[model samples]
Target chain A: MLRIEGLTAEVDGKPILKGIDLEVPAGEVHAIMGPNGSGKSTLSYVLAGREGYEVTGGSATLNGVDLLGMEPEERAAAGVFLAFQYPVELPGVGNANFLRTALNAIRRGKGESELDAMQFLKLARARLKELQMSEDMLKRGVNVGFSGGEKKRNEVLQMALLRPSLAILDETDSGLDIDALKIVADGVNALRAPDFSALVITHYQRLLDYIVPDKVHVLMQGRIVQTGGPELAKQLEASGYASVQAAA
Target chain B: MNTVVHSGAEGFLHRFEGLRARLPGQRLAWVQALREAAAEQFRVAGFPTRRVEAWKYTDLRPVSDAAFDEALTILGDGDTLPAPRGERRAVFVDGRFREELSQIEGASFAIGSLAEELPRLEGRLGALARPAEESLVALNTMLFEDGLLVTVPTGVAGGVLELCSLASRSERPSAFHPRHLIRLESGASLTIVEEASGPEDTRYLHNPVFEIELAEGAVLTHARIQREGVKGFQLGTVYARIEAGATYDNFTLNAGARLVRNEIHAVLAGPKSACHMNGAQLLRAGQHADTTTVLDHAAPDCASRQTYKTVLQGKSRGVFQGKIHVHQVAQRTDGYQMNQALLLSPDAEIDSKPQLEIYADDVKCSHGATVGALDADQLFYLRARGIPEAKARSILVEAFLQEAIEGVTDETARAALESAVAGWWEKEAA
Candidate 1:
């Protein structure tokens, strides 16, 4: 389970996430829907331990392990994964080489024997096939010259390969089309198990139609104002975030 | 040569006066005149300082301050040399050829020590170089004891050849100036991998000068790797002249030495000739490396391309100066140059200058330079993917150098460069 209490964060001396209290139990997928300045992305970045995001007062944990006190790679080893809205492009870095290195690093952290190149290639090719991505991606530089849809699909492919217990999708469906959205949703749904949980943060209700969340929370002004079942996402779609803003 | 006296360069001039009769090719009148003219130039100019335009970024105070004695005899037979990178090897110890340590049994082309081949190298030795113009070249021309001399016959494809310069461990500070002469006849081709290395704690100088001549329809690929000791200094220069339909491809990697300067002067003197120069400089704390090149387009329809990358860590410094000159009669010339630097620490420094002087109206020349630290977003992305911080930094550094290494076409040379880069990362991370 992933839990957060009184999460207050600032960027460059300005508050962005204030008093954010949320929790997602195991075997559940929750969605956080908000407007442009609702600080949705900031929440995910803070949870991932990115630099420059100063946490004034916050307590976040996964399975009773403190998340705020560890490095980004340590948080990843503790089963925290953040799918970036803008995937960084790494020129001259081959995708196959990068994925293998990441996987081997995590495995080493878990005291697991590392996989050789051929074995890692087999696993990566299988994951690419499931995501419907071309094997040519393994040959080129990571995210270099990739289209918008291709970048999104690459993120999903990474999430599948890493297989983190707690995944955070921050505005992943922004530039994706319906078909691409379905592929991403299937990738997430395929990892649904008793030990898996996810926090799907998005803006529109169209993505929720494909991957129905167990719970939906209305976030406004860096705070969660209301919480309900999946029907809250549909209700917000009919009545925009303005209604939630007024109620808060 | 007369016992001319100069202030800053008197140390070398005094040595040249004492070693004139014992130097190689002393029996030839042309060689004597060449040495005398070079000595005269060195006597007048001395070692270059910061005031000079070409030596603005690099300072040679460390070289001039210390008195460097000459290595009189060869190292003992117990000394080990670096492994050869090609089939044929020509080894040089303390700038003198070591025939027993070399392995050039069945070489198709002509390869021998310049000291032994001085009779055959009458006018070709000093034909390409301008010792009267450059101080370092003049210093090398006056004091060079021995070097490699290679010549390929017409239409023959001379295979891979390794020229290794190893500086022996000495108790006192010493210096060696090796002058190499390489020529390829028309329609001939050859690949040369030049490796220079020394003991980890030796205080010495390995100043080499190369004079290359490429005839019509000929090609030469030269790759140089400099890994001098921590207390050593290296100041090397190369002069190449490309004729019609010839190509001069050169790549250099600077990863060692307390201070180093590698200079190249390439002149495209014939129509349709090309010159491709690429290099990477990797420096750590207390290290300084410089790569300077001057490309001259003297004929019409010629092309030149240059790309250089420098990665600095700790308190190290890096410098790159590239100039492309197009003559008035050189119409339809194409020239491009780019230099990029990545500073790994706040204390690291880089000085990059890209210059272009084009007199032709139909020429196309472009130059660019970029200096930056590692990208934060890229670093975070890699860390978030579970790669350790040190590993991620190494990965990014390797990626930045890969672009420059790709321009090297020869497989053997490229492999040698890749291994050197890997070794650098290992030492850095440790």
Candidate 2:
């Protein structure tokens, strides 16, 4: 459901994501494994339409619609969700309010009726329950003073609430513990459907163990050098990115 | 200290000479003398200039050139006091109390116009609010039309008092000075909401002076929301003297008027009293709102706090000046002041001054101020959640002001203020 052909991007006049090609079909979970400065996060940010990341020469599409042409909110409305590695701390914006606004915004964009406060609270409570999150976290400021695990969990919770068609989890397992990883993986696994797809960007292979990917892509120097089955992650863990870099 | 007289005040001096004959309480000898003395004070001091520290951020030259005379027309036909049903209300049109619209007949405490109760209010009229160094206060004292008077009986808990001020229908811009008096007897209590508003697109001046005195063990909660006409000018001052075991809590929301200033002077006169001054200023597009307060801890064991927040956008300006003074005998006093502003535009400006003068040996006093823009990461995060850029901005601005708005203790008052802020944001966004 997601396609990137020759996805070249840059930040601060310096090339980050040089020509890259990748695709994730419907109902499949794809894991992108790379070391630091490999442009994995850059690709995720470009997909999410964040500022300061200029897509120089390539085209990325979700559901065959141009992603880079839309603003951040428009991209969100078009079902592009990004689970940030470090969720921003909003001092006065409550998590529950933020979730409701986002849900209603997307729903409105799709010409659907917005949910009332009662309905929103009920829906948010149920989602939090499924994600093993407490209601108190939703009452407080979004990601303010939250632990690393809580921030990641909140990101996953947001993904669960939005239920995007193409979800991009950028380094979701970076600061997570074993339990948090399992919870986050469960949150993603529950959203699996014939129309749902995910691109999981991770440094380690541990996250893929819980949410097994149908395909594995090795990204080195702004290019996806290799694509193989899920067992490719096992081999990469056994060895290291040094071999992959030399091969690329 | 040398005083710098402004030409703006000199013009006002000429305007007051013709308006003095029609001032209220003309029959009362003390009241007339009080007005004359205040006029003399205005002549001597003139308007405070930029050379003076207090009037540095604000200038009265623009207001001086406006041709706003006395409000000649009262509440006309089809006019209504916007007070909610069942709430105690004392409505005023052009600084004159509207007895027909006012619903203070059956309130537990006494409420009437200053003109009707001048005999009873003579002793306390100019007592609490003696306009000495301030030219605006002096001008208000000299040219006041008619104001409300509320007196809570001793040992009785009073209900919510709604003191509302609405501008009248006038072709040319009009000006009104209202002198309100509030007295709470020993062991008395009261909560008051003062709202100042006018017809949209009208140019008027609402200069009101409030004198509040809380006796021993009394409690007073005052919330003033100033939503004058968008093109109007509002300059108001409040003087409160809190007694032993008394508590005076005041909260103001400055959201309207092209040029607005709300000044407050609170004195803790008895031991163990407390006073809190908290407010929020929301301005957009050439609006200028200022809030200045002075807290005096004159007795031992008194506590005072001042917290203010301002949000400015589109070339707007905001000013906050607060001072806390602890007397030598005021040992164990606790005084704190904080001012913060959020600038939503590059052209927006905020000036804050916080001062503390402590003579007591054992006292805790601290002050701080901050001026900054909205966090970029916060805006991006909100926008990423599908909220539009404008919606995200208003949410953060409201949140920034909520820190000070939350200081209002009463629930009904808090809700009223919150809804008012929401309404202002809606209009601003639109």
Candidate 3:
């Protein structure tokens, strides 16, 4: 469902991701573990089509379609989602209203019928309940004054509502407590289907224990240096990235 | 070399002199003296320019150069009052109050023309009619024909009072000086919504002045909505005095005029008085809007809060100058002021100066001003959520202005102001 080959990205003339190759088939989950500044977040941003990140030499495709050429909104409408490491706080935009707009935008782009306010509210209420969130969250401004765990859960809620085919979780587990980590993992695990794929980016092996990735890759200095099964996470957590860096 | 004295400053002074000479009834000595003093001040101050420190960002050259003749009497049939929308309506046409169209239903309310009330309270007129140092205020005082005077009796709950000023004409460059005097007696509570509108194609000048007096323990909610014509020029001044234990709240929304200036001067005269002033200005195209305010804390334990937001697009310009002054005697004073501007276009400009002057060591005062374009990261975040770029920008802009609008106490008036803001956004996009 998602593929990246020779992805060389640079920010501010400094090459961050030298070369990256990754693939996640439908119904599979791939975990990318890296040290700080090893371009774990850069890969997600590049895949999400954020501006100012120069893709010097790379090709990223989703479902055999070139994702690099699309705008951020276009990529979103094409079923690409990025759960931000830090969710932005929109001071006046209500959470429910923003979710409805986003849902309708994606649905309209795909030639689907748009949901009315009543329908949108019903759908949002059920999703919020499923995520163990209160209806009061819908009335407040989007993520404004939200606790760290609440922001992470809100991001998962958005992913569930949008139902993007390809989801990139960039450091989504960094700030989550143990309970929040389980809730977020449950959210991700529930969305795992034959048509949906995920790229989980994290700095520790803690999140992997909950989500249980199908494949694990060690990213060092902007390149994938090692690949293994779930045991790779355990080895890395036991030995740390210093040995990984020495080996690379 | 033969040089003509531009009619910009002198013509209005001459017309005011002519009006004074034609007065038939016996006038109060203090009223006459105030008129003369205002005329002299107008003559000396002339017109404000960009060189003045206070008016550094706004130049009144266009208004000074325009030949604004004294507006002739425009007495309309009672049918043109635009059907009163709220309780207690006062209509002012061409700067003069129309008693026939006004509706004063309650017995505790007294509504009349300031000119008519001047002779009766000659001694109080001087105290209320202190000459404002600004050139526009001086001009409005010198040339004002008649203004609205409203007073709510002590311990009276006057409900809501609507002051509507409508200027409609296509002939001469008419000018209106609509002054408002509102006195809320002790323990009295009132809500005043000042609505100003005019023909979209008319080229007129509106120089309005509102003087408010809040007795001890009184509460006043004053909201001013300016929807003047696109070709019009508006220069309005609001001077309010708050006594001990009184509460004064003001909200000003400017979405009109080619050039507009709304100045507010508030004084917390007695201990424990509080004042809250908030405003929003949305300007597009070649529009120029200015909001200048000063809060004087003269008594101990007084508090003041101010917030002003401006959104500029196209070639528009916005100016905000807010100052908080805590006197030496005003110990334990708490004052905060903030001015923020969102520049939607590269060519748009915003000049903001938030100042705080505190002579008391025990005072708490702070001021901040910021000018920037929309956050690119936020924009991208919204876009990634499948929201379009235009809608994302509007959402952010609305968020930026929401805090100011939330300060409006009246729900209906607040909704109206929000609608006005939405209308401005629609026009700006078009």
Off by over 4 Å in 2: B1-22, B74-80, B83-86
What TM-score fits each model? Answer: 0.98, 0.95, 0.92
Lowest summed lDDT over 10 consecutive residues: which window, candidate 2 chain B?
A: B77-86
Report per-candidate DockQ: 0.88, 0.68, 0.70
Ranking by lDDT: 1, 2, 3
User: Which residue runs of candidate 1 sit more than 4 Å off their true CA positions?
Assistant: B1-5, B73-80
Better of 1 and 2 by DockQ: 1
Against the true structure, whose TM-score is highest? 1
Q: Comparing 1 and 3 by DockQ, which wins? A: 1
Q: Of the pair 1 and 3, which is ahead by TM-score? A: 1
**lDDT of candidate 3 over B363-414, digit per residue (tens):** 8888888898999988988998988788889989998999889888787668
Per-residue CA lDDT of model 2 for B28-69, tens digit only, reads 899889888888888777767677788999987678767676
Give interface RMSD (Å), model 2: 1.0
Give each model's whole-structure lDDT.
Answer: 0.92, 0.87, 0.86
Off by over 4 Å in 3: A241-248, B1-7, B21-30, B72-85, B98-108, B112-126
